[model samples]
Target: MYTRLGVVEYPEIDTHRTTRLFTTDFNNTFILFLQLICFSGSLTKSSLLEAVRMLATYRVHRLPVIDPISLDPVGVLTPKRILRFLWHHGQDIFQPSHCIKTPKQLNIGTWKGIHVVYPHTPLIDCLDILLNMGVSSVPVVEHLTLRVIDAYCRCDAMNIAMQNEDFKLKINVKQALEFKTFATDRACAVIVSEAESFYKVICKLVETNVHRAFIINCSSVIRGIVSISDVMKAVVLEPGSHLNSYCISHRRFAEFLFETPTMETQAEEVDNEDTKTSCTSRSSSRTLS
Candidate 1:
């Protein structure tokens, strides 16, 4: 009746504590509400650590690589990218003594941009973007600077609908975000360099309890991102364990088609009803006996 992933509450920062604004829809799905921005880099251990901490606290799955000086959008960080990096390097990653090329060493080509929306974009329009792109959130960027100012996730939409209940799609994104008092400490984006090691990356993520890290080159150019799933795959492949079975625990739920009561149970209920009716009739016929 419940999913394994859903059963175990994943460890994440309490949204209530992290931000002033929170919203939900009638179905209880968390709508993308808060635009807390966190960024990390692939170069420096300190930079990566801070980035991971912010991502985990904000519950973001991925982040865009942005230049600090220029504030331009660059590449993105994700779980799959991290996995590939580990696959190429192997157990050498675990060895403390070995020094490897930091993520900055790898050239991620020209920073291809990801999908983004504007702050004033209508909720209905952004919703369409989410559905069309099949993305959980869309970065709200400054049109001219290409700076990522905020983010809108499906969770926020869900929460907004919960609060509004009217399902007004015409509202602007800023209006939807009005539930909270917006503030920022530093530039929201996390920046990292290419000189950091995989050892540091893993530690930063584990310590910060985040899922993804973005990479940047020394030039402050965006490289790419890494994710927790990527690291796990690397670990699994190292032990010669089959990746197929890693997902086997998920099959337990699929085996049962329906968990509702069986036809036999329904029949039993009918039979009990009949017995009760007969008893009532017999009592009435006997009067006060």
Candidate 2:
């Protein structure tokens, strides 16, 4: 589950240590947050080894790039962010030597200062992030440092949604007509807030023996994800809650069908002009046998 990305623990700067190279402030102190922003061009991502080492060695949660004199969170760095990035973008996030574009042409991935969360955010906000933005997690900010504090996932809901046939059958009867697709979308993760830590995430998942967790931020804003994998890595050293009963229940329910097929009425096969036009509009590829 561990990837060569994002942050570990936030480091506490020893005020007693003397150094002209480092700076200090309230943002970087409390909660082990990141104050300095970090960035590497899409091509520079691989070159960030030194920077990643600096943050890990210091136990800093995030590091953002800033104006030498005026500190601004132009870009932020966190372990979770790096991990997710690599998982989605691949390990070549910043490998200049691996550029695939033609020479003299700069084609970088479209990245923006997005998917950031504020300090003291709530879990519900993260739920939106997972569903709408399709991200696994968001960054928590202190003094504008986009550090990660929580993550959300649907694995929890999936467990609940995939439960007993009797329960699922009953619920499906009522809600099946409303789903956009004929596909099943049983339960979903709902993050309550920043107060919920990875501990809550694990307990909820283990208690449910489900793999996903729904996350939301403070003020009930749906921010984005925190999955079982995310929780496992974050809580790797901790004693996890066991879900023996839940797992048994989950196993029993895992046999349930996910998609409820829509009943098709038996009608005489006929193609009206409109139907013919619609069919023609759909792209079809033919292969020779």
Candidate 3:
């Protein structure tokens, strides 16, 4: 109707608005990131060698150790650290024939000083966690696509909260800018596609740590979301479904803050990657190939 009335699209605004970290809220959050990890393996569980493999093969930043009994996180290991250690201090690398004679069994609970977060929290919250805790991604309840997550905004809720008398006084210019500095990415949604292979989607996820990937039917409606949580949980709890169960190094995933752009890309890539199906209701069931 607006088009019929001779109105055109917003001509003045720019489309490449989100990618600039300086322009988006993500730029500020980068300061809070204590360290960019580059290592593999934990002290309690998962071998140093296998941890190295996960980092090298999967292209992740780090690998954390989990306790054998409780499956709790313990220590942080990064790819760079591992490579440095291996390259500089080659003599002490963990080898089966070297000394791991007893074959120790461990899980999550036995470790110490680990950080985590639920998936639903905003990406800004995730940044807060990273800044305050000196740790990378928290464990999220689900997986999400960056494209879908970009569609939502943090200010949308802030506007409602600010209307109260008490709240009105709180939003100063500093706070206003801080409040405005939030993700504009679409909220992660589920899609169903004619996807034939589970591994292919999972591979894409490993590279991105997205929330959910959908498999669709012919009608272009959502069939299911292959969430990161689903894939990771299955890897940890149900090994058979996981292809390279041994490779994942330290993973920083769950972010309470809204997601911002990590990749250096143009607008078309983001537009196409976002699933066509939108506003999907939360579903408890997960689809596997």
Q: What is the C-alpha lDDT of each candidate?
A: 0.44, 0.35, 0.36
Residue 196 miss distance in model 1 (angstroms): 5.2
Instruction: Pick the winner on lDDT between candidates 1 and 3.
Output: 1
Per-residue lDDT over 15-53 for candidate 2, one digit per residue giving the tens place of the 0 to 100 score: 112112111222123214222222212212333444454
Instruction: Judging by TM-score against the true structure, name the best candidate.
Output: 1
227: Cα error in model 1, Å: 3.9
Backbone clashes under 3 angstroms, per model: 25, 60, 57
- Which 10 residues in a row give candidate 3 its minimum summed lDDT? 280-289
- Model 1, range 222-275, lDDT digits (tens) per residue? 344444644553444333343222111212222221232563365456556566
Descending-lDDT candidate ranking: 1, 3, 2
Candidate 3 residue lDDT tens string, 1-289 = 0000111233322211212122223322343341222222233544554554454445445565654334466776664454345434653433332232211111211123423323344344443444465333333322332222221222333442344333332222224333442443433333324334444554444444344454444654333344444433333334333344344434432221123244334333533554232112111111100
TM-score of each: 0.42, 0.23, 0.27
Give lDDT for model 3. Answer: 0.36
Candidate 2 error regions (>4 Å): 1-177, 180-185, 208-210, 237-289
